[model samples]
Target chain A: MSTRWYPIYQRGNPQLRVFLPNFWMKLVRPTEEQPPNVVTFAVSTEMTKHDVKNYLEKIYKVPVVEVRTRIALGDTKRDQTYGYITKNDDVKIAYVTMPKTEAFKFPDLFEKKAEQLEKDEKSMDDSKEGFRKFLERNKKRPGTPGWFSI
Target chain B: MSSTLMKCLSLANTLRTATLRSLLTSQQKPTLAPWGAVVPALASHVQAVSGIHTSAASLGLMEFFDDPKVWSENEVKVGRAWKPDELRIKSNKELHQLWYILLKERNMLLTMEHECNDKMEVFPNPERIDKVKISMENLETVVRERNKAYHLLETGETGERPQRLVHNCFGLRYMYKSCEHVLPPFMNIKWIKSRNVGFGGRAVRKFLLQYREKLYNEKRKAKNRSRNEVMMILRRNPDFDLEVLRRQFPQVNIDKLRNEDKARGHYVPKIGV
Candidate 1:
């Protein structure tokens, strides 16, 4: 069943069926190269392997062959001044194997963003240069109004 | 073709309404029916309810959006959020039906918001999401209240998580909520080991003493600083409202301080008979 709260089960408890499962699974790019059917997801830490499998199969209607999950320890860094170490919360990474018939490739969201970034940088530089020129022009005529210039 | 779309739209609306009602009314227990078996029945019910509004060129669930006439309009008028009293008056079945309708409405709003964010355009009526969230929260609160009352009546304990104030290893006080476990406390070696590791050490005692001293020092300095500030203010502005100063700095004894030399102004005082 889903991660929703339910009554405790007795010895011969019937299978619990979750009506509305609220778990969200985001498809993420795998760091290392893997088989075509093997996909990775950064799921909620509380999610179990079965939950991930059911989530993909039921919600997204994707055929899941097998599911593996691991809680990866987050990076810990020591502060330069304080010397105290800070650690990020561990994340549950799910490696799901889909049916061979279906294949998924993580699409690059930032592919078109590179050109936009270049244009933004160019505009920023132009503005900075313009401001510098304005400052130079007013340097010789301190307190003199800009309207007084030719 | 148009009629089919309208039918689907209506079905979704009905389901959404039903879900919302179920979420709101805690008194009504959900009939434990296998979802796979009841899917067809639920679908048919949705279709039956949607058939009522089929005359208007059968639009899909998305058809619940603002009319094409108002698409370009800057603003759209809408009613306020559904009050708890109004929802409470509705029958359980009606509420259940309404819940599904609201859920669909919420999903539609989220879809629209996502599309707007992607296009870098302003989403019309952003408050719609807030209204839906508020309604959902209120419904959950109502359900929780009913659940708590039921549990209190049936059992001595509340059906919520049990919590208690506890001092951690750092000697800091915090609320620790107890939860269910497969193993008993004695059997749970990991939990027992962790609990054993928590608190009681010479280093911890030293740290707690320093921490408390630091806190006390801050409080004492603050009080002394305020007292000095009041004295200075009285010395400069002798005619200042003593009542207001005393009220503002409760820690400072303004009445006794008022008779001090520092509180007396530089101006000559007239002798009293």
Candidate 2:
């Protein structure tokens, strides 16, 4: 509670410092094609354009050429059973621009996912084959433990 | 000098309300890093700012996105929360840094959760959010404990936001947390008006009467339930210790209730000294 408390900022009084900022910003994949230097972000609703600019420039150490922000309205849907309307929380999307020379593409997070699945499948098949062989060897002595023989 | 004056003018001209938050650049500048570390100048370039030396390779602004390695994993394993005792040993600066780290982690989790929900996919290891929240809460408690100890030692006060019990319009007592105000008590017309709420009219009297009646009803029912329980206990065991019953239910008068019809057992009392 004390952490959230901020002193009133007067002209001559010392400025209030936020030691822990509760605001969050997420780097979202751009829906449309744009310059490689421009990264789109979905940020906390309370965050301002200056906060986005400073957040990248300070915490993330990313050079920010400019920042543009807008609040996107959440989608509303009617319940299937009750026909009651519900809406998602509105989000603030920030478009942060870096220098022309710097480039960032939202890396395909699931690029190696297919390869991982194949590896897991191979391991599963190996385990299955081993279990089948163990069952075949233990057919005559059903009560015997695998460790007792191997 | 002219450029700075022009910059200040442009800052003043913008009425976005959020940019005004940056006006406290002086106060927020040093907090991003430790005292001896590189101080982020208000006009400095991004390359000059190195908030954490250990995380040099960790890209900024991308912290909110999910780690690429975990994109295909069905679950993410995480450790337990930082206990209060563990946090108690950490230095204030370390705790402050931990707070930022937890804050960022929480943000990352929230972003992932939102994206997962949007995509109609389950967010993996939801407990990670709870763990981070617990750690943050514990850290804050530890900090508060230290602050209280320090304040008690130095200022003879808790050094917390002062609060006082006050009566509301419904004649209910509540603890009102006081906040810092630019104006004094006398100058705050709205606060003064709110403080002098009129709870004296017949309507307020009726409301208070009904409220008190509701509270009295709850107390009366509780008293009745305890009395009946004591009666049942006495009826079940005639030789039951009175002292034990007295200690258990102080509100119920044991001696008087012992002679009541409800306390009398179905069978005649056996002859005993």
**Alpha carbon lDDT of each predicted model:** 0.62, 0.73
Instruction: Place model 2 in a CAPRI quality band.
Output: acceptable
Each prediction's RMSD to truth:
13.0, 14.0
The candidate that wins on TM-score is 2
- Model 2 residue A106 distance off true place after TM-score fit, in angstroms: 2.6
Q: Compared with the true structure, what per-residue lDDT tens digits does model 1 show for residues B180-264?
A: 6778999999988877656788999999999999999999999889988998999898789988997899889998888888778
lDDT of 2 by residue, B13-85 (tens): 3322322124223343222122112122232321212222122325565677656667656566444566788
Off by over 4 Å in 2: A31-34, A74-87, A111-150, B1-57, B229-273
DockQ of 2: 0.38
Candidate 1 residues A31-118, lDDT tens each?
Answer: 8998888887766798899888876564445678999999989999999999999998787888988888766665433344456557
TM-score for each predicted model, relative to the true structure: 0.51, 0.71
Worst 10 residues of 1 chain B by lDDT: B46-55
Give the C-alpha miss distance for residue A23 in model 1, angstroms: 5.5
Candidate 2 global Cα RMSD: 14.0
